[model samples]
Target: DQQVKQNSPSLSVQEGRISILNCDYTNSMFDYFLWYKKYPAEGPTFLISISSIKDKNEDGRFTVFLNKSAKHLSLHIVPSQPGDSAVYFCAARPVGADGLTFGKGTHLIIQP
Candidate 1:
């Protein structure tokens, strides 16, 4: 069964606006969340991460929020730029698991 899911297949945001990407999980064992951004031909690079113990985490223009009760998480990018256009994957790791489960990913298009 798919543990992680990004309900929206794609999202479009105007430049300099806030872009919100959402994700949900069915596994209660998940204890960590990671957001990765991938370009057309490049490997997915880490964007930001948050632990289940916390509700939010931020890094520069990127922020990740986790809601254990709802089994949902989201990534927010403020002041979206042209270079922010890419595919974003939501990944989660279960307690004590060394590997991570990834969602299908959402294509974020930054319109300028």
Candidate 2:
């Protein structure tokens, strides 16, 4: 069974607006959560991360929220832009785990 899942296959947003992407996981052992942005053909690049102890983490225009009780997390992009258009994936790992569990990913389109 998939440990992490992205219920929405895609999302659309107007440029300069806010974009929200959500993910859910089944593993409570996951103590670290991360978001990765990917462009076609290129490998996913690190975006943001949140520790299990924290409910939120932010970087520049990107923010990540974690809700351990709900086993859920979300990524927020403020002032979404065309350049920010990409596949966003949610991933999680245990405190000492080597590999990460990733959601299928949500395709985001920033409409001009």
Candidate 3:
């Protein structure tokens, strides 16, 4: 079974608005969570991440929140731009594991 899941297959938002992406995981041992963005025919690039010890993490125009108790996580993108349009993937890693478990991905489209 997949450890990480992105329930939404795609989302559309107007430029300069906010885009919210959600993810859920089945493992409690996952201590690190990451969000990666990928363009078609390319590899995923690491966006932002949060440790289990942190409930929230923020970067310029991006933020990630974790709810350990609920076994869920979410990503927020502010002032969405057309350049931000891509497939976003949610990934999780064990406390000291070398590999990551990834969700299918959610396609985000920024409308003009």
Candidate 4:
């Protein structure tokens, strides 16, 4: 199966705190992992990504960590802001497709 699972459909955090989102995949062939953030009525924007060969990747306020052995990955947002409130999707794909399998999504709320 190509399912990527985000068990929690939502998360809430206060501004200035850390926001962590978790995801799991059953497909061992997936070698590329990515996270995308979306605002209302807009397409998801790529946030961070890591290859199966790497364990971590970071960009500004975002960081992504992948554990190949467990087929798990996470996204961390530091100093969360109300502006960060939106849906986050975790995606993965095999090395060549460039196409992705996505989780249902997590609605992250950053409380002011």
Candidate 5:
């Protein structure tokens, strides 16, 4: 079963604008949320992570918000730049699970 879902296949944002990527999960046992950015011909790089117990976590230009009640999460990128364009994947790990479930990923295009 697809426990995690990234509803938008792609998102476009103007340079210097804010881009929001959304994700939803059906597994209530998930206790961790992670966002990864992937570029062509390269492996995904960890962007940020948040625990299910927390509502928000930030690291520089990246921020992740979790809503346990809603079983949803989002990644917000401010002042999007051309270099920020990539496929973003949302992943979640269950409370006692070692593996993570991932979404299909949403391609973010930062337009000039």
Candidate 6:
């Protein structure tokens, strides 16, 4: 099954603290992973991605780590800000697929 799971439906963090979001997958064929941030009405925007060949990837304040053996991944946001409050979705695609399978979503709330 092409299922990506985000166990937590939401998270809250104080500004300037660290925010951590988790994801898990059951599909062994997924070789590429991505994290997207979304606002209420707009579509998700790509945040960070990691290939199966790599263990981690980072971009500015965002970082993603993948554990292929465990079929798990996480995204970390350092010095979280109110602007960072949004829905985060973890997605995965097999090597040849054109689309991604996304988790339901995790709403990140950054309290001022």
- The TM-scores of all predictions, comma-separated, are 0.98, 0.97, 0.98, 0.95, 0.98, 0.96
For model 6, residues 6-104, the per-residue Cα lDDT tens digits are 999999999999999999999988999999999999989999999999999988999999998899999999989999999999999987889999999
TM-score of 3: 0.98
Residues forming the 10-long window of minimal summed lDDT in candidate 1 = 44-53
Worst 10-residue lDDT window for candidate 3 reads 93-102
Better of 1 and 6 by TM-score: 1
- Give per-residue CA lDDT, model 4, range 3-89, as digits (tens): 799999999999999999999999888999999999999999988889898999989999999998889999999989998999999
Local distance difference test, per candidate? 0.96, 0.95, 0.98, 0.93, 0.95, 0.95
The sequence of per-residue lDDT tens digits that candidate 1 reaches over residues 3-95 is: 999999999999999999999999999999999999999999999999999999999999999999999999999989999999999999999
lDDT of 3 by residue, 3-22 (tens): 99999999999999999999
Tens digit of per-residue lDDT, candidate 5, span 26-50: 9999999999999999999999999
lDDT digits (tens) for residues 2-112 of candidate 2: 999999999999999999999999988999999999999999999999999999998999999888899999999998999999999999997788999999999999999
CA lDDT for candidate 5: 0.95
Model 4 lowest lDDT segment of ten:
92-101
Task: Give the runs in model 1 whose Cα sits over 4 Å from its true position.
Answer: none
Angstrom error at residue 111, model 2 = 0.2
Ranking by lDDT: 3, 1, 5, 6, 2, 4
Which 10 residues in a row give candidate 2 its minimum summed lDDT? 88-97
For model 2, the local distance difference test gives 0.95
Better of 4 and 5 by TM-score: 5
